[model samples]
Target: MTHPPSAHDAPWWRHAVIYQVYPRSFADATGDGVGDLPGITSRLPYLAGLGVDAVWISPFYRSPMADAGYDVADYRDVDPVFGTLEDADALLQRAHDLGIRVIVDLVPNHTSDEHAWFEQALAAAPGSAERERYVFRDGRGDGSEPPNNWKSIFGGIAWTRVIEPDGTPGQWYLHLFDSKQPDLNWRNPEVVEEFHDILRFWLDRGVDGFRVDVAHSLVKDAALPDWEARAVMAGADDEPVVHGDLGPMWDQEEVHEIYRGWREVLDSYNPEGDPQRDRILCAEAWLPTQERTMAYVRPDEMHQAFNFHYLQAPWRAADQQRIVETSLEAAEAVGAPTTWVLSNHDVVRHASRLGLPVGQPRPNGIAAGDPQPNAVLGLRRARAATAMMLALPGSAYLYNGEELGLPDHTALPAHVRADPAFHRTQGEETGRDGCRVPMPWVAGEPSFGFGAPDDVDTWLPQPLLYGSLSADRQEGVAGSTLELYRTLLRLRREHDLGVGGLEWLTALEGMPLPEGVVAFTNAREDGPVVTVLTNFGEVPVVLPEGREVLVASGRLHRDGDGRRTLHQDCTVWLG
Candidate 1:
């Protein structure tokens, strides 16, 4: 029905890029000031034109709107606010028609309290089957304490009292996120069966695959020891005692058992290397160590997971390079491919993170108190980061407005925000809302290029800088960051950037590794091995030797026989 390109023409994973669209703010077609499935369907052509291989839609499933759709009350039906099931079918079909695959989000860790199953269990009598659906325990028998002392990531205690079906007043249940989302008792066989059915419902829906949310939290310690009572005594700050263990037991052998079962099921849907219908299972996990991170990507666990080390690392080439190398090494050791990510819904935008002023009170881009050290070397830094990301040997994920050089804190107010983590950590640390504000489409619109120009207000306020920070305005200007993204993506596909044999070569301090400049070469048998040099500094950096420039941040340079000069932040390609 569609005519983009045959599946065989392009390998499912090779030479392909994924573009993430946050459904709530992509576009508001209904004029209700919120985006929906129809709004996303209407924007299909634009995404296809952008030359991405797939679209990963953040959860649009039915829920109480807690955590922005992650708390699912129903798996088979679409949220009315987003659209009907028919609209979902249409959206998937339209994306496929444009040679773009559609990947939906799946959250199996917990369920909304409003779900019929949870409600039934909440009312069932003690010792009933329904009561077993969640982690229910008898509370403070006579003079006893809670099952465990695990503190909630949001703040205080993780346990909430819920009356038993027997009308007992002292029963409690565990919830990791909110009381609104109660954690499921995976120890129960029926609970596992119900979730497996949930997975199959989507698998049968013609969707390309899924991005599994919080895959590791499904299993917990059955002992349920009160964490605070343990000898570990992690209680050091104003906060409650931290959980004591994070060893193999922390992952629970049962966790691997569950994932291996899911992998068997995914295999039934699409066997390995099946191009026409590939079933991908990417996970979102956060752990402190590399060994812990690997548990999520074993051969039978997740196909890939986002690399967060870089996202949290301090902005420095040495720091970033080590993170990148370590991630790649760990993935290879596990015999699984890696997914490179620089930005996501949960982190500050790279531009804001790179260029924020220190000790300044500037709202928007104003110099508030004093400027924090953001990457003052703007355009060049952006170009270098892009080259580094794209040249890596794996799938690359991109956020919506990153290509347009969209700056953060443009106009998002402190109020009208929804991230609990940000609100919880205010003053001490900020959450990721600054980067999630509405996109600037046209510079002329009073709504700052996001909502309709004639409309009184947009869903998210159109920041005042909308006039200058827009994709439309930058599209007309040569060498704009927006243009650079388009061109670089094209070159990636046309020139085969990371396809064949390639090796990384580094120059140490004593060996002419010019200050703030990094040079490396890719070996190719059929053609000239490409040599790339990047400059993250402000001034032009001189090259080592025998290097010719092909592409720069703002302009392209030529060898002119032997010596090469690269402007700051720009990258030069040579063959």
Candidate 2:
């Protein structure tokens, strides 16, 4: 059967190259050593020049910052650390003027305990309207024990007992993350109505779309059954437990109904005659299978869902190829473009993660006492992997510092680390602070020129190695990671590769390729066909005959017969 058209046939986000800006680290315009909305506005021209079609700003909402702004206190205003509502408006307008769409992060799974509703819940008696908005339960036995055996994703009991204002022990509330962030009761109609209004609030301010955080976690089973430990639920030491039957806490079937309601809100914003103005929703669901993930991107639900399976796949040709095929097929079935992401704010940077032992668990963070990463080998593989991602058939996402080939500061001092996971795991996990360090802009400048004043200290300390990877140092330099990105993005637009269909060249007749290599062609009906190949093995491989070279990750060697040879861990583009 033929695929159906997506929500908007020619929407820009369908095949867009989106750049994610983790606001706290992007730029420090306020001189407070924290990046803000104004700072991001100042850099729109740079993003436009980088050839990205859109920007997804991480949460800048008014927050206590207990979980680095993911624990939002007020959904309508910006945090003091990120600037005011006017600043956010100016940034959105500036981005639109530059032909770049803006997508803001929407955290719907929970709210900061300081939120008015949560505060009211604390003051009100149990079974009151305020308490009904959250998941409040009575403790079993002596009212001191937790209601169930549920463990927090952050490494403790999910339930926290609250003391009544009368100075007696009280009912317990649930927080899947940190205690400061309480899970919302999606079963409450008021919670549903509130978020619906929140959507309209942002869309009215000219936001093109939203990136829904924890999209698979809004709903829970009504019965709140006990979690049964299964082998599939036992994840690796470093990775989060994302798969398996996580009872009542994740991946409930009722979550889709909520997205369908959200889709209606997004559809209402489309002007009668302009499909280009349609607002979109992208889900950050970490489901077990691609088929389940695609369910979030169906026509009446979200516009897209991130393909984490592909991102978490090992750096092997066979594994990568299988994930690509599965992801494409799943998206095609629902008529949604696949979204490929390599790194983001939550995980360790892929550059360093790929350098670790192949079969071992990729840790969320590495401590000073742990084995260090091989920077040289990691950067090379990261560059090659980026080239391959850009040549694929769907939209691609670039994290803030990936263009500079930045490796995680794996040896960050334990005392200075801010990620909640670090404290929750008692420094054993190291947390995601390494990946969230501020971006480097200038060499030899204090804080690497992240702030306006050279002497300003960043919230997170920058390593000495950042000097060599600063954007100012890499700009205009041949073969620099920054230059490579600019070149690839420019080529992608000029050749229409982002909107083209993909075909595996290795499956074609008379194709010459070695094992542990991936080869594919981006084909357009009226444009030139582009071939992309990557060598993941130790040995070199001969390139296809008579193809014009477009670009390559590294220098290509020529044999006596004029055949081009791709070296190990290299990718090349040809037409």
Scored by lDDT, the top model is 2
TM-score of each: 0.85, 0.96
The weakest ten consecutive residues by lDDT in model 2 span 230-239
Q: For each candidate in the order shown, give its overall lDDT on alpha carbons.
A: 0.64, 0.85
In TM-score terms, candidate 2 sits at 0.96
Residue 351 accuracy (lDDT) in model 2: 83
Across 255-354, the per-residue lDDT of candidate 1 in tens digits comes to: 7777777777776897665655666777776655555667777877766776666555544555656766687677667866556776666655665655
Evaluate residue 397 in candidate 1 and report its C-alpha lDDT on the 0 to 100 scale: 81
> Residue by residue across 313-405, what tens digits does model 2's lDDT show?
889999988888888889988988898988998877888987877767767788788888888888888899999999886788999999999
Error of 1 at 358 (Å): 12
Deviation of model 2 at 378, angstroms: 0.7
Worst 10 residues of 1 by lDDT: 229-238
